[model samples]
Target: MAESEERRGLFSEEDEGDPAPDDQEGEPRTPLSPICDPSHLLHRIVVLAFMCFLGFGSYFCYDNPAALQTEVLQDMNLNTAEFMQLYAWYSWPNVVLCFLGGFLIDTVFGIRLGTIIFSLFVFGGQIVFATGAIVNHFWLMEVGRFIFGIGGESLAVAQNTYAVNWFKGKELNLVFGLQLSMARLGSTVNMNIMGWVYHEVGEVVAAGHTTLGVSLMLAAVTCLLSLFCALVLGALDKRAERILHKEQGKTGEVIKLTDVKDFPVSLWLIFIVCVGYYVAIFPFIGLGQVFFIEKFNFSPANARAVNSIVYIISAPASPVLGFMVDRVGRNVIWVLCAVVATLAAHMMLAFTFWNPWIAMSLLGLSYSLLACALWPMVAFVVPEHQLGTAYGFMQSIQNLGLALIAMAAGSILDTRGYLVLEVFFCACLCIALMAVVMLYFVDYLKGGDLNRSASERARLQKEAAAHSE
Candidate 1:
């Protein structure tokens, strides 16, 4: 009878011990389990699609001025120097504001608040620009563009933050590519249709034709749509936070300006690459329609058509290239390839009499490839808490380059010729290639694993997990 009693006591002790440990462990794992489950895949995709919508309007309005460049110059009776201010105004203010904006997103404001506020700036700026156009006040238009610049690039930082928040380490590169693709699509649609909108609206205004202001007003409508998407995304993000308990076990880190010092040498090299590559591309695009007209002797309409091929091809190709990067993981190699292709394209434009279409199409592809490969690396290197500031600083530098280069390129075109500008572009591409090479070496020395394919990275992740177990 005493032996039977002792056996029962042992069984009771085992039961109580198991429950104590299980209860302690289960609480933490409960919140994380849902995220790892495949069932949440649809939720993630929907979230990504919403994120894409947030930038669509910003991209559309940003490019509209370039799309209607000739019309704005002719209607406003402005010289090229004055007209280039439209781009300069959009770029110069963002030099400092983008960094601050990113700081706010990381610390003071958080992603949702920053995105909404920046988007509102975009909307308000577009509206003010349209009003300036209606009044035929050049100063007012410049002011409006300046205001738009305040929000434009900063909003871009917020968008990056959002993508990292939701998609980091889970097809992140591909998601960025898709976001860029959507943005480029907005620009492409603007290129394809802005001229038509201008002409069509003109026909409607009692046959006297509409003013450039009317076309601008139409672009403002797109800004408003983007603002609406921002609000919707904010709500959805909040809901997800609540449902997933994403913040339950987390502490908010205080973001400091000094955090900038922590970024690796590789990131700085990437920034220089970004500035060089974009200076070669965007400023050229800002001036490209004129290039086509001057060099190929094409009409304004035809020039725009040729210029837009970059955006048009990028709209579809960016996401695909991003997916390949996600699967393959040779981001640095792809970026180098892009730099080479861009250099070749500019050379053809500068030196050869080859069909501009061939050169333009190649440029479009290169632009897409670089974008998909380069931007995601920021996320890979920087901690999530600092991503906003990191992305912002990069934009600030990029904007500075773009602002200075656009103004200078305009002056150069007026004084020298398209050949000089094309040569300048080639020089920028060469510098980008050099920076990219430096980046590759820095990454290699750090064992960043950025040089590996996506599958290889995944294999490494699995091996680490097994070893830990």
Candidate 2:
């Protein structure tokens, strides 16, 4: 009860105001530095940039396998089963660990500390992966991926927590979209640049296995960049807390594990959309290089480019779509449209002989729109305190589906071929579409906050606060 009362009217303020009454005492507020002024938009944009790059290393290293799919297979002599394990190992552990990781963010490490630690996990894991590749040890690489996975998903939770803590009532959707853009930027870079990195390193390493490993080791540089960002962001957050007269430690609030059973049905529906939709995207991208090669009869180079199209387009499109959603003010409608567009893209890939460039471009734009619409809604359904746990649980489930479906995707491609795999992806999107429709109704019955325009939501919040007085 103390926690509940303390959390009231917290983390929702988007503009500068006085500290809590007890916080201010019988004294007037002190002047803030120009940099510390809450009204400073430039300072916030700088922070937003840091938040955007927080996932850079994780996204870059994740698609390393996909980027080097042909190379890893040929150089390491790995079959589809072994190659897919790289992704499976990374995702499988996150199924449970990331949920606990999120809880830890709320209870023990707090967001700043948890983020730093998780980034460290990602860095260390990638090193292990690069080492395994250099030495030609698949098992060691699996272990590296396992460690990387531990930090990767939890790092995302910490990122979400940071975003809500800072931008919850402001342009939260734009922040989420921008974050997705930077992360996808990481992925796009990996896809386009890693091949070049491999070729360059192959000169010294003389090609084959060590070239792949060395390239991955070079890829670890982005992880280092992200770690630096984390450290700087932590310092910034600490400084902001002091200057803003915001309370620390008590700020994260508590989210007990037992609270999961009480989460809203709307949140669960969103989770279904999360897992069902992404299993199609990520897994398809993981296996997509080969898919394009086989189905479209493209060269290896062209296939990699096509496989990268989603991230490339999304890198730019996500922020734009996000701004549109912010302006339009109907998140549910945007999500549904994104889902339908994705389904259409998949169906085109599955059945039509049309140019894949068109399909991939449409798919990328729709993906951006869905990401812009979907993620920030969690912040609305759950209280600020529960944000970490809620985001963690959602990611936990998504990784479970990724782990299982990635392997299945590999098998389907091997045995049933690319056509069957595309169909499988289509099926997952169909499930996501249905879930979005159900979410629409459920959110409606609960007063429609999720679908409300920015003005409407702000009006309702003000009324609720006034009534609580």
Candidate 3:
């Protein structure tokens, strides 16, 4: 009787004294909130830093050849056709290996092993290149460059995929911006340093003071620096992997190569866009020095010097556009980039005869805009698990387009002449504009709004309902 009275007293206090209800069966419970952790933030910063280093190495490899092209041709005693063929050969491996790299990164190595192995290839290729140049063997140098392309292409795929993994929805646009900006810095440094190197070496050769061996040594030193940077990156990647495993309680599966067949239509459209942009861009890079020399009557050194300005502009432009996209929306930034690129291409085609400086400025803006917009969009469309394969496939397609356009551009210049070259660039710009239109259409079809926030919210609500049930 006493125990019963105590229970009644507890119930009476809850029922009569307390304003809050004892049981509210119809009301929903608040979901658990996610807490921000310091470790996660640190991991992201480390990944970003590593990605910047990789960008620096990759761009160094890309721009190094351009700076040394004239010297290489002279040293090897190659004609214009042969030199162009060698350049084409260097790109062919990227066409082949880009997809393979992507699949392997996603399914096999993830970022850690993929990056390490590819770096070895880059280091080895540079060694071979040095040897070839020292021996004055053109074929050997071509072979070295082909090997380098394979590794370099893979490295590029890994870096982009890595960015997706580490950044994701948190500050992703900013990370991509910084990544691209660093790459442009690499290109700028390559142009400035390589120009100086070539000039110094050319003077030495002219004075009969040193052999081509000296230039080869310098190239080898840069390659070693790249390899060292890769090693540091690999160590950091392993640390990140450890942290991820501890946090997630499982290691993520690496992407496999065979998944290319399963890519969504959205990814395929992105691939097409990438191809169109690169096809227009790389050929222009290849021919820019030549054009400046022939059309503007500038010396090779002066032409290369002017070309450096484009890369210099790109270094800052990427980050600014990236920040804008992060704050606003990707679609807005993409459309803006497309508009700028279209205008720049048109300006170049129309006014190269009027003022080369204007054309050069337009070219710089075009490169900066496309780079900032196009690269980050991949992370938006592709799932994290498939990032490697998607990047690889896109790169392969892009490389193929670049190879074809470069060859055609060279041939047209040789056969049909400069008018055909102008026509080709104009056509490429138009195609790129179409790609931008298609992207907008796709976005509209997905929803009227460009931001995916509403969709994400809906998904979360569904998940919460499942958990409650």
On lDDT, the leading prediction is 2
| Steric clashes per prediction | 3, 0, 5
Q: Show the lowest summed lDDT stretch of 10 residues, model 3.
A: 1-10
For candidate 1, give the lDDT of residue 173. 55
Better of 2 and 3 by lDDT: 2
What lDDT score goes with residue 382 in model 2?
Answer: 84
lDDT of 3 by residue, 1-469 (tens): 0011111111111112111121234454343222222135664575567667764655665655566556655677755456565457667987767546655665667666777788777767776766776777777877877777778766655665555555545355556557666777777777667757766787766522134445655755655665666677667556544433321111222446777777765667666666666666666665666666777787887777776777777677656754554455545346547655655654565456666666666667666556545655555565666654555566667667776776777777777666567777777766766767776777668763434443564676699899999
Off by over 4 Å in 1: 1-50, 106-113, 160-177, 204-210, 234-255, 259-264, 378-389, 439-469
In model 1, how large is the Cα lDDT of residue 265? Answer: 85
By lDDT, the candidates rank as 2, 1, 3
- Cα lDDT over the full model 1: 0.74
Clashes of 3: 5
Ranking by TM-score: 2, 1, 3
lDDT of each: 0.74, 0.79, 0.59
Name the candidate that leads on TM-score.
Answer: 2
Clashing pairs in 3: 106-254, 106-255, 107-254, 107-255, 107-256
lDDT of 3: 0.59
Task: Give me the runs in candidate 3 sitting further than 4 Å from their true place.
Answer: 1-51, 102-113, 157-176, 205-213, 235-269, 330-333, 336-343, 346-351, 375-389, 438-469
